[model samples]
Target: MEHAAPQAWLLLALWLWPLLLMALAMRTQWRWLPALGALPALVSAALLPVGTQLSLPWLLLGTELELDSIGRVFVLFSALLWLIAGIFVATLMYREPIGSPSGSNHFAQRRFNALFLLAMSGQFWALVGVDLVSFYVGFAIMGLAAYGLILAYGDPAARRAGRLYLALTVAGEVALFAGLVSLAAHSGTLTPDPSLLAAAGGPSLALILLGLGVKAAIVPLHLWLPVTYTAAPIPATAVLSSAMIKVAVLGWLRWLPLGAVTWPHWALALSIIGLLSAFYALLIGLIQRDPKAVLAYSSISKMGFLLLLTGLMLGQPDLLGAGITAMLFYATHHALTKAGLFLGLGLYEQNTHQRRTQQLLLAGLIFLALALAAAPLTSGAAAKYLSKPLLQAAPWHWLSPLLWLMTLTTILLMARFLWLLRFPASKAGWEGTAAHPTESSAHFELNLLAPFLAWGLLLALIAALPWLFAPASFWPTNSANLLLALALCALVLILSKRGRNPLATLIGRIAPGDILGPLERSAQRLRTQAGRFQPGQRSTRSTESTRSTDPTSASETALELKLRGWPVAGALWLGLGMLLLLLLLAGAR
Candidate 1:
């Protein structure tokens, strides 16, 4: 009982500490607030034992928080990434002048810190929460907070990205809510277990997948990812890619009956979709000119790989334990390596004029990229090694070859990302500038050293991941594949250098959100054509005047115009509404 009390407090502190720090940051606007906020989560993840549960009967229809094996790994990596990002945030706060006590800069700094910490708290909450309501609450908070981060700059591009992100986030939340309701009603419980999940209906499963898929950046639902990554601040982008997106995978692991049932049809369908997403994202990623956009697509591809593993597990229940471990390890490796790259890129841009620092940053980026590519002796290699058994055990004979292809594609994408980093697009605002002129040398050095130390620690973790996790050899057994990928990348580089560079022509051809750009344009054209058929200004004003007397009519008119402004949004809302209605009806029946 004594042990239980401590464990419960630790679990609560893991999330509450960040919230408390967020409140303090809003008042103090302290530069160190972000980093300090992450400390409790880090400590809790490290100190807490597995299976530690904290139940709150009075909280959100009786919620429970537990540190299971999956949650332990997730919390550890997430806290590490958040902590490192917090360090980078501290440096950013230091560089930018906060101005006077009541200045706009001060307010902006406090707002950013508060949102960052809130997101951190929400992430921890979602990760540790065992019940439906707690998970949903945390997920929604994190998603909404991230929208604010995306719009921090409030530029046209940032606003546009924020709009898209919010729309998708809301859609995902609605789907998730409906799915959870169905699951709870069907199972007659809020907390899920193997037996309950196994009996979950097909509609609930599909809805859950649909909801989580948006966050997971699953193919068609992935349009927001690249745009948001490009528009958001670097630190924000780092956490979004590394930690936020992985929440969906955790949701899948929790909600789906991976080890309990063998649904071969769902398994095969998901596997095919995963394979397609991997290759499709790789193709789009290669053509991207922006480094962040490339990284975003890289995330999509990695998610696809995880989805493939998930599908395999669904078909073969026996692979569950090994599969989950492999997935968790891969997720950790990718999170650390990707976050390091983003942070390193931010550092690279900030120290552009410093020749020595630039060189060092470039070297670190290359190392991180190599690790992401699963090069020998790196974390990626180790993760791939761990997954080998699952792949070998799969009934499908063609899965292994496709996985090899995906790995090769990943190497190429990383190479492209590195190449893109050489020519970062210039931007206005704090992102492009450095320290204030009046700042002391000591402060500047400290700011610079903090980010480097955080990045270096992350790199060290990536390097040691293999030794820490992988059994047997740290070297990838499939060293030949790595060599082949390297050779291919080299050959392409040589050919491009020798020729007129066909790859250059492909750059920027497809925008960050591949289909979205065209879809918006098409919608604009359609709106223009439709406007011509509408009543003249004078007639429209007369009609509006007639309707203005009725409050409900005036509100409906405004709603109609707003919906008309966003053509795609109308369609999405209509479809979602119908789906929700059907789900409600089904439940009632």
Candidate 2:
């Protein structure tokens, strides 16, 4: 029994290991602590058996770790990816050559290490968690900690991306929380409850769907992703897009009513949205210049497929047996491939003379995985084959074409992403060596390949999983639709090369945060208006002119300048006042 509940120890170790590492990292001469930190959780998760459950009555949330078959798939996949990225980050942990020497304690900062640890804890906890509340705590902590990374690194553009990410993330979290609340209120007393959540009926189910929708980067909530992925450091972007985002998927898997009533209408609507968003992101991705940005958009496209799967599963909760397996298989596929690409792009920055060679290699890998996304007869093809029966049963067969379109666009985007990610050597020698980096050693290259190789191994498992478990008779899969889809995508890419320049043309025309452009512009306009209205502008002009003529205005102008600073200061003070009043109101209530 003690061994059976080992997940409790695993859960505790996930949190405590990082904290210990961070504390040790704080005291040691170590600069690359982040990379070393993710190891224990990864190893423990792999060793832990599926169906294990753990409880901690002492904690506020009473920590839980339960492993369903699908959750096990996600846990191992996510845990491995995080560790690999951590290692990659560790390789670069020493200060940039431009900074102080290696031995300097300043090479690492405690704050950055702390945030990384907290984020990793959140991610690990979320992956292994059994119930809704435990999952939420992990999810919230990870989200907040990741925001810290954004603030730590982003400049003006990064900050804009940060703000966009934060706003959308908060909105998503709110929806998810609402769903949990509704679930707790409605579930019948007879139902068994997961430690994290009290069960509610359909309304709670709806909440979980909506909440997961935002976090999962489905359709409308997906816009912030490309911006954040583009702006973040390669390592940060890799984990953020790949592993961190899976938190939402895990959330939906654990919290939603998979075995309860199916919502076909909602499911259908979601499938349509996923189908469209999947293609739409690729189209936009095709036109973009930055490869990281392209990968971000590609992630959105890939995530949409998962969203569609979620919809289908919701519609036929009874099919959860196959549905959960399919979903797990699909999630693992995307995580590995996407993380590999993000890290590969980061490493692609290393090659100098072989730009075209690198580009060709990159394009091959991108399309290979994207084809998997399309379920081209490669293992992904088989995965897609499994999904067909579910879609065929839906009210309309036409949805299949939509699915094909999603697959085809993924092919096009994958091809386009390769071209965009291609390192153009046209300006070759003009840029310095920094722009064209080299692998520090064979070891470094191998270190970087860790995540990609891990993904490739998982993709290999696709062919084996269905055979071992369900053992369905072969339907004799056909490549005709797959070929037709690829050819059409190729033709589209060739004929519409002109559209590739649209990202530049649309930059000012379309803000990076998708629909938030208008709001951002409005705020900017308001600032401009405020700048003019403030007597500060007029006073500044007078003060400058007066410095040459009337000395008193210049002196008073300095006073005015000091007073202008007070507005920002005053705003802070006012914010504090408002906060105090709210706290008082809460106390009264």
Put down candidate 1 lDDT per residue, 1-589, tens digits, no spaces: 2245665678888888998998798789678888887787788888888888888765666769898889988999998899888888888545753434344467767778888998888989999999997898789878878887887766788989999999999999999989998999999998979779889879998999999999998998999999999998888999999998899989989999989989999899888888888899999998877888889899999999899889988988988999999999989998888899889989887775666667678889999998888888888888888888788888898988888888888988888787666644222100112222222232225568888988988888888888877876867565787788779767766665575455656777898999999999999999877866777634556767878798989899888878744235535754885786576556545
lDDT per residue, candidate 2, 485-505, as tens digits?
Answer: 568656554444444432334
Scored by lDDT, model 2 comes in at 0.63
Model 2: how far residue 9 lies from native, Å: 1.5
lDDT of 2 at 483: 66
The CA-based lDDT of model 1 is what?
0.83
Model 1: what TM-score?
0.87
Candidate 2 colliding pairs: 35-86, 131-196, 132-196, 133-196, 179-207, 183-200, 186-200, 187-199, 187-200, 375-381
